[model samples]
Target: MNTPSNRPAKGKNRAKLDPVYDLETRERALALVSHGRSLNSVSKQTGISRAAIRQWQVRIEPISRTSKCSRPDDLATYSYLLGLYLGDGCLSRHPRGGYVLRIACADAWPGLITACRDAILRVRPANSVYLVPKQGCVMVTGHSRHWPCLFPQHGPGKKHERHIALEPWQQQIVDAHPWELIRGLIHSDGCRITNWTTRMVNGERKRYEYPRYFFTNASDDIVRLYTDTLDSLGVEWRTARQSRRAQNVSVARRASVALMDAHVGPKY
Candidate 1:
């Protein structure tokens, strides 16, 4: 019975396979490292090698929200941020070299304003995020060098006039978190509300109410994307009449509203 067991010799070298991680998991681990977690500690907790952790942290070092190289990890959060940017986000460059990012959310929906602020804080923690009230909307503004990295759609002209298209990575992120993207779009340039009207029933005037979601954007492509997203979610939508310069799309119907409510509710 002293015959060799099915095992390698004590001092023999064995091949090691590198770990494969999905984008979300990789982002989470890198985020932990950015938040001042020691590489060894993160490696121990995440079961990832310290060397790999170090490399991940280093890869996003320049575009990190924190000086320590921590970037936002949640896919939904980034997708929401992108939606806010595409809807009413703006970027301004500083004379010193960095950039300022601002997204306008209606003050009526304070929750959305808070959400925007939180999103910026999660990505660019160092920058002071604040609200600037303009007309009926509140602008969530912050400064960061890597904002363009997140919203590559930044350009000189308005979104509608420009050729706004999502990149492969961004498309992947949106595909993974379509609801969040929809939430951002609605929060920025859309609304979910109950419309009411009066009708004659049995020779008597009666009032009826229905819930509908309206998304108004000047960009046809953006509207197409919005409708496409609704189709993917199996929600019904149709084009609504709006100004000649703007395109309006509406999602109305009991079942469709119910489905949308599951993923996106009115911004409080």
Candidate 2:
């Protein structure tokens, strides 16, 4: 039998190119190509690819250029390690290669954390690129840069979020991982945080600050932190709309309460 090699193979373009792009750029490139920009024009202008530009505009969806990583014999570790490291920043501390996962769609639906977990199971990481769940998406990015500079950059002509966000859950994750999302989205919800409280401090409106943290389906910490922090600051906030599902049944009781006796009001 021929001897097997133990070394990891190199990428197609093995040089350490900057790994700072997010899904928004890809969508912007797609839109540009769809609007009649040529691949060469896109390349000269955006620095991605003639091929990628072509793929975006093609009538048939073309193949993805990003490489996927897998272990021939060690399939378990990277996959097993991804979740643990995601929480503790184990992989982010590496000397090289990490990635950001930014998910986008044309539909009017909000993504569930289950969708994120599913995507992670499907995509493979590249040489230096690895997949870790970034709140609602799995990040496949390089580790050299902190997350703040990684994905979902804010700027004019960038890909925009078409759907209303998932609320304080997304806010918490963005706080912890600024690179995971554009700061614009974080600030969008800033209004809610402040609006929930009218409690003035020193004659000025008190501001609610979001603590930095990552969001995950596996944990409630993000939600807990958000609600707790807001409550501690005396901000009058409620859980997300989805969270309101449980409260819906009792919501009708507001009218019913008026029909009950005050001394023996229906117990909550």
Local accuracy of candidate 2 as per-residue lDDT tens digits, 1-268: 4334744446644445534556446656665665666778877888886765565556224223342222222223222222222222222222112333333211221232233334334333322444444444344334322232222221123222221123343344434433222112111111111123356889898765432211222224323433443344333434333342111011112332232222112111
Candidate 1 per-residue lDDT over residues 1-268, each given as its tens digit: 3447865555443323455765445666776765677888878888988877777666765534343333467778888888888888888764333568989888788888889999888766667887888999888988766677777788897889988889898889889999888998998889988999999999999999999999999998788888887888899998888687998889998999998898889889
Clashing pairs in 1: none
Off by over 4 Å in 2: 1-41, 46-56, 64-73, 89-126, 129-218, 221-268
lDDT of 2: 0.34
Candidate 2 accuracy as TM-score: 0.22
Candidate 2: C-alpha RMSD after superposition: 18.5
Lowest summed-lDDT stretch of 10 residues in model 2?
A: 185-194
**Top model number, lDDT:** 1
